[model samples]
Target: MTGSGFRERYLDVLASIYLYNEHRGYTSLDRVLDAVRQRCPDDAEFQAEIAKHRADEEKHYRMFRRWFERQGRMPLQVDSGVGHIDRFIQWVFRCSIEELDTSEIVGSEDDFERLCRVIMLTEQRGYAQVEIILKNRLIMSDPVMKRIFQIVHKDEPDHFLPYQRWLERQGRATAKWNERAADWCIHKILMLAKLPALFLDAGRPRLQRWPDEDDAITAH
Candidate 1:
C-alpha cells in the first residue's frame, strides 16, 4: 500500500484510524446501555433518552458491521488500532466508577453532570473519528462503506447533544457536597483511566510502520 506514495497513503491511515475507533464504540455501547438503563433516573424523560441512545447504538453497530462485513473481516477480531486502547478505556471507566463510589461524593445534580461529562467525552471522541471515517472517500468508495458511515454518522451526533445540555445545567446549579465530590472523583478517574490504552496505542499497525519485514499470513 505504501508504494502508492506517502500522500496517497493518507487514506489508508485515515481508514485504519477510524476502523479502530469503530471497534471501541460498538463494544463500549453495551456498557453504556447497562449504565444508562440501570442508573439514569426512572423518569419518563430519562427513559426516553435511554431508549434513544439504545436505538442509536444498535443502528451504529450495524453500520460498522455492514462496512466491515463488506471488507471481508470481523472488526472486533481485526486489529483496529483502538481495540487495545478501548480495553484501557474500559478499565479507566471502571476506575472512575470505583473512585466515585469511594469518594461518597455524589447523588445529586452534579453527579448527573459528571456522568454527562464522561458520556460526552465518549461521544465526542467517537464523533471526531467518525467524521474522519465518513470523509474518507477512498475508504468509503465501496457503496456499502459509504452508506454505512452515512447512516451511522447521522444519529451519532445526537448522543452528545443531550449530555452537553446536562453540563450546561450543572454550571448553573449549585450541587450538594456529595454531588460535587462524586463529580470530581469521577472526572479524575476518567482522565486517569484513559492513559493505559493510549500508552499501548503508541505502537500500531506494527506491520505498516515497519513494513515488509513481517509475515503476511500471521500479521494479516
Candidate 2:
C-alpha cells in the first residue's frame, strides 16, 4: 500500500475498533447498572452517574457510526477480542463479559470492589489513549473524525471519576498493582498483536448493520 493508502486503512481500522468498544461499553454498563440496582438501590447518585456514563458511551458509538456513514461504507467487523474492557473483564473475572455473573458481584462486596477497580482502570486507559489519538496527525487529518474524538476526550475523565470516588469512599484502593499491570498488558497486546493483525487482514468482513439497530428492533 502507498503511504496515503496505509494512513486511511489505519484510521479506518482504528475507528472501527473504537466503535466496537463503545458499543461494548454501554452494553456492559447495562449489566453494571443491574448490579447497582440490586446491591445499592438507595444510592441514587451513583446510579445516576452510571446512567450518564452509559449514555455517553452510546453517544460516542453513534458518532462513530455517523463517521462511517459519511464515508459511505461500513466499519470493519470487530469482536470482543479487540475490546479493552472485554479483555480486562476476562482477565479479572476469568470469564467473558457475557459470562460475568452480576448477581454474584452484587452479592459480594469484594467482588463489587473488584468490578469498580476494573472499570476505573479501563476508563483511565481509554482517556490516556484518546489523548494520544488526538495528537495523531492521521486522526486529525479528517475533521469529522477529529471532532468525534475531541468529544470523547472531553467525556472520558468523567467516566472513571465516579468509580474511583466510589472506591475511595469505600476505603478501598482505586486500583491494585496487579490490576494496573493487567491493564497495561492488555493495551500492549491490542496495540502490538490485535491491531496489526487486523490491519494486515484485507479479507476482514464489515458489519452489515449498526450495533444499535439490534436495540431498535428489540424496542419494537
TM-score of each: 0.53, 0.97
Q: Write the per-residue lDDT of candidate 1 for residues 12-113, one digit (tens) a residue.
A: 343444455443454444444555555554545655665576566656545554554455543222342233333333343444322334222234544445
Cα RMSD to native, each candidate? 9.7, 1.1
- Residue 68, candidate 1: C-alpha displacement in angstroms: 3.2
Q: Which ten residues in a row have the lowest lDDT in candidate 1?
A: 206-215
What are the runs in model 1 whose C-alpha is more than 4 Å off? 2-42, 76-112, 172-220
Task: Quantify how close model 1 is to the true structure by its C-alpha RMSD in Å.
Answer: 9.7
Where does candidate 2 stray beyond 4 Å? 217-220
